[model samples]
Target: MVGNRSCRIAASAGLFVVLAGTAGCGDEPATQIAAGSGTTTTSGAHWQRLPDAPLSPRASSVMVSSGTEVLVIGGQDTAPCPPGADCAPGRITRDGAALDLTTRTWRTIAPAPRPLLGEQAVVIDGVVHVLAQNHGPDGYDKPARLLSYDVATDQWREAAAPANSIGAALTSSGAKLLAYETSHEQGLVPDRILDGGTWRDLPRDPLAPSFDRVMVAVGDERLILFAHELVTNPGADKPSIVQAAEYDLAKQTWRRLPDSEIIGGWYWSHTDGLLVDPSIGGADGGQTGNYGRVYPEGGIFDPRARQWRPLPALPAEPSDDLWQGPATGGPELAIVRGFVLDPGAGKDGRWIRLPQPVRGAAEDPAAAWVGDRLVAFGGTVHTDRKSAFTADTWMWQQ
Candidate 1:
C-alpha cells in the first residue's frame, strides 16, 4: 500500500484519467469518455467518441509496440454459441499486423512461427522480445523459451529459455522485462522468471496471490503490478486483490501499495497510469511537474496523496442477453476481472478512456501504448466451461 503520506497526496486535488481499450465486454458494450472538473463525477465529465480498430474478436494474443506501430498478435476467436451452449474450440493467430496511427491503417505482417498462448512480449533496445510456450508438454508444466522479433526486418529468432515456465504475465520496466510465475517447482518451492530468461526466488505472499496478472510502467522508472487471488468457486464474497506492490527499477526494490490507499477501495481487477486531462484542474491542479496518475477501477489511486478515491459505481451489470451466450458463466460474472488504462492523448500523456471492453479479459492481457492509442490483445475470459480463452483485439485512442 502507498505510505500514509502518499495516500494524502492522492486524496488531494491531483490530476488523473481513466484509460481503457476494448469492446464487447458484455451485452451493453458502450464506450464512454467524459471530461470532468476536479471533482470526479459522471455528469461533470464530458464524453468523446473515436474510431475503433478493425480486428476480429480474440483473447490471449500478444499486443506490444515496434517503435511507432501498435502490433496485435496471436489470439483465439471462439464465437457463435447459444446461451448455456459450450463454446467452440479456440483459434490461434499465426502472424501479426500493425496499426499506423499517423495514417490510420492496418498492415498485416508475418505470423508467429510457433502458435501458442500464455506468452508475453516487450520491446527493448528496439528488439521485439517474446517469452512463450512451445506446442508440447514442456508447455504444460515447464518454463517458456525466449524469442526475439526484429520489427525493422520482420523476422523471429530464438533466444534463451527461462529456468521455469514463464507465466502468462510479463511487462517491461527499466532495462528488464519482468516475468512472473507463481507455480511451484517440483510442486514444492515458489519461483519467479525475470528479464525474459532469468530466474529468482520470490517471497511467498501471505495474502491472495497468483502470477496471472500485469505490471505497468507508471512514471519514468516506476511500475505498479496488480496481483489477484481468484477462487474456483464463488461465495458470499467474491475474489479480489489480496495485495498490491510498486517497483522502482532504478532502486531495484519492491514496496507494497495497498489498493485502499491507492484506490480508495479495493481495485477489483486491473490498473493503469493516466496523465490527468489538464481540463480537470488546469494550472490549479495539485502537483505541477508530474501530471500523470494511476486509476484502478472500483476507484482511483492518487499517487500525490498516496490515497484512493472511489469512482462512480460501474454501470449496473448488463442484461442477461448481453450476459448469456459463450460469455456467461457463474453468477460471479457480474464482477469485473480485467481492464486497460490508456494514455490516449500521447506525448503529453493526455489519458482518456478507450470505450472497448473484452468480456472476462485476462488480468494480464498483452497490452501496449503505441503512439496515441493503447491496444489490448488476447486474454482468458469466463466461458460456458466456466473459464474459456479469447483471441479478440480491441483498440482506443484519445
Candidate 2:
C-alpha cells in the first residue's frame, strides 16, 4: 500500500521512438536466452516497440482497453527502506495516460480528483470504472468512492461509494459492475451492485477473514476473488494466498467455495472458471510451504461443472520471479507473462512463446488484449524499494 501524500512523477511528458533488441527475465520460461534454444519462433506474430508514453513508468497501475486506445492509470512505487524495517512505504498517483491504437500515439488523460490503485478496475460498456481510497487506515473501515472515466470526453466523474469498500475490489459482469471486499475486512461488508450510476448493497454473506489480497477476476455471470489464507502453525506462519469465493452477479448472492485442492497455488480466472498453477516445491513439495515456488504447471477450474482440470506441463521451467500480468482468456489464453496457453492448439494444448520485448514485461505492466494485438504498458524493476520504471510500450502483433 502507498502513503497518502502524492509524490512527483519521475519523468516529463514526451514521446520518443526507439528500436532495440535482446531482453531477458532471469530464469523465466525459455525467454530465448540461449543461442538457438531461446530463439523459438511462433508464426505470423512479432513484437513492435512503440513510442514511450507521455508519463513516467509505474507498477500496479490499471490499464484498460477502450477500442481506440489503451489507458494506463494510477500506480505506486516505494522509497528505499531503512536497514531494519520490514518494508518501505510507496506513493500512489492520480495521474493517467492513453495510447491511440491506430496512430500508435500517446496522450495524457485527466487525473481523477483522488488517486487510485488496486485490483478493483473493470471495463463496463466502453467506460473504465475504478474505486478511489476514500479513507485512510485510521482505525475505521470507510467506503471507497467510485469513479468512472470516459475515453471519448477524456473526463472522469465521481459516482456513489459502495458498501464499506475501502481496499475492497470489483469486477465487471455484463453491463453491471460488482464490488466486494476480498474478505470480511470491514466487518461483513456487503457486496455492491453498481448498475448505471447508482450503488445498491447486496444481501450480506459471512466471509472468512482472509484479507491479505490478490486478484479479482470475472468469469461468466460470477466473479471470483483470490485472497490469502493465514495458517497458524507452531513454528512459523505458512499462509496460502489462494482461497477464493464466488459471487453470482446475476443473483446478487455469494457462495464460499471449498479450499483449493492444491493449497497456496496461484490461480487466475478463465472465461469458464479459474486457472491454477498447482506446481509448488521446496520443504512442502506440491503442498503448502513458505511459497518458495514460482512457475505454475497450469490447472483450471470449471465453474459450471464444479471441477478442476490440469493443463499440459510447461515445456521449460521458470524463474522464482512471480508472474506479473493478469490472466487473459479467449482463443489464446495467456496465464504466464510471455506465453499464451492455447487449449485447442494441440492434444494437451501447448505454450506459444511470445516475442521477447527489448524491455521485458510481466514485472507489473498493465496488459490488455486489443483485438489480435496484445499491448503492455510501463513495467518497473525495484531495487531497495528504488524503482526503475520503463515507459516503453510493447505490442505483440499477432
Candidate 3:
C-alpha cells in the first residue's frame, strides 16, 4: 500500500490555494503565489483552477478531448516501495474519468477492462482509441488490446488489435487511424492502418527500431513521422538524432527529408505549425533527458520549407524544473511546461509563466485544446524521497 503522506491534498473550493504552513511532498511549497484572489500570470495569459478529478493521482495517464468533453484514461498510481522491495508494476490503475470543459465539472466513467499504464490514446471521429499493453500475471509484456470509447455515448468497445504487442505511436489522419508497432521479429517498426474498424498493415520501407517517435498529420494526404534514436543501454553514451519523413497516403511511399539539426525532443503540433524542444547539452557533453533541464531554447519546424527555425528562449523561472511542451493546440498560442508562449503576438513571441496548481516536479501532464482554453490534467510529481501522482486540473486562457 502507498503511504498517506503521498496522498494529494483535496481542495475544498475546486481551487488549490497554497497555505502558509502547508508544503508539497517536495522540499519547497508546491505552488508559488502572491496574495491575491485573482489569477496570476507573467505573460498576460490567465490561469484558472478547475475541479479536482475524481480519479486518484496518476502519471503516464492518457487524456484525449472530443468536442468539449475530455477523457482521462488509465495510468499508474505509484506508491512508495517497501524497504528492500522493487516497484515494478507500481499499482497500475484501470479507473477512468471525464471532465466537461464547458461546465468545468468532472464525472466518473466506465473503467478500463484491465489496468493500463504507459498506453497511448488518440481521438478520431469523436471516438477515443486506447492502445493498451497486455500484462501477464507478472507485468506488461506485449500489445494486449485496442479499446475505443465514444464520447457521446460514454461507452467502450474493443477495436481491431495491432500486429505487434508493443505500440510505438498512434495518430489519426482525418477519419483514418494509423497505429505504429514495434516488430519484435524483424526488429523494425511497421504501420497498422485502421479501415472500417479493422487494422490493415501498410507497406513501408524497413525503418530502424525506435520506441520514441511522434506522428502528426500534416494534411489529409500526408503524415509526418519523426523518429528518434533510443538509448537501449541506459547510462551508456549515445548520440542524439532525429529523423523526419513524410508518408504519402495516395502514392503509398515515404520520403525522407534532410536530417534535422534539432535533437530528439518533445513536439507540439498546431494547425499553424510544429514546435520542437531540443535536448539540452550538459557540461559533460551529454544530452539531458526531458526532466533534466529547463531548456530555454526551442525551434519551430516548417513542413513547407522542410527546415527548423529558432524560437526565442523562455524567461527564467524560480525553479530550473523542466516543462514538457507544445501541450495544447492553437494557431496563436503554445504551452511549454506550464507557461504559455505566444509566437503570433508582437515582433518576437513572448512567454508567460502561469501559476502552478499542484507544484513539485510535474512530469508528463496530458493537455488538450478545449474550445478557447487549454486544459492540463494528471501528471506525476517527484519529491526528495518519494513520487506521487496528481489528479489536479488547471486551465489557461488569454
Candidate achieving the largest lDDT? 3
Question: What RMSD, rounded to one decimal, does every model reach?
Answer: 12.0, 8.6, 9.1
Q: Which one wins on TM-score?
A: 3
Candidate 2 or 1, higher lDDT: 2
In model 2, the runs with Cα more than 4 Å from the true position are: 1-44, 76-91, 134-143, 195-198, 204-220, 223-260, 265-267, 271-298, 319-331, 359-364, 381-387
TM-score of each: 0.54, 0.69, 0.72
Global lDDT of each candidate = 0.43, 0.54, 0.57
How well is each residue in 107-173 modelled by candidate 1, as lDDT tens digits? Answer: 7767776675535567876777777675444446665667777777877887555455544445565
TM-score of structure candidate 1: 0.54
Model 2 poorest 10 in a row by lDDT? 3-12
Measured with C-alpha atoms, the lDDT of residue 231 in candidate 2 is 33
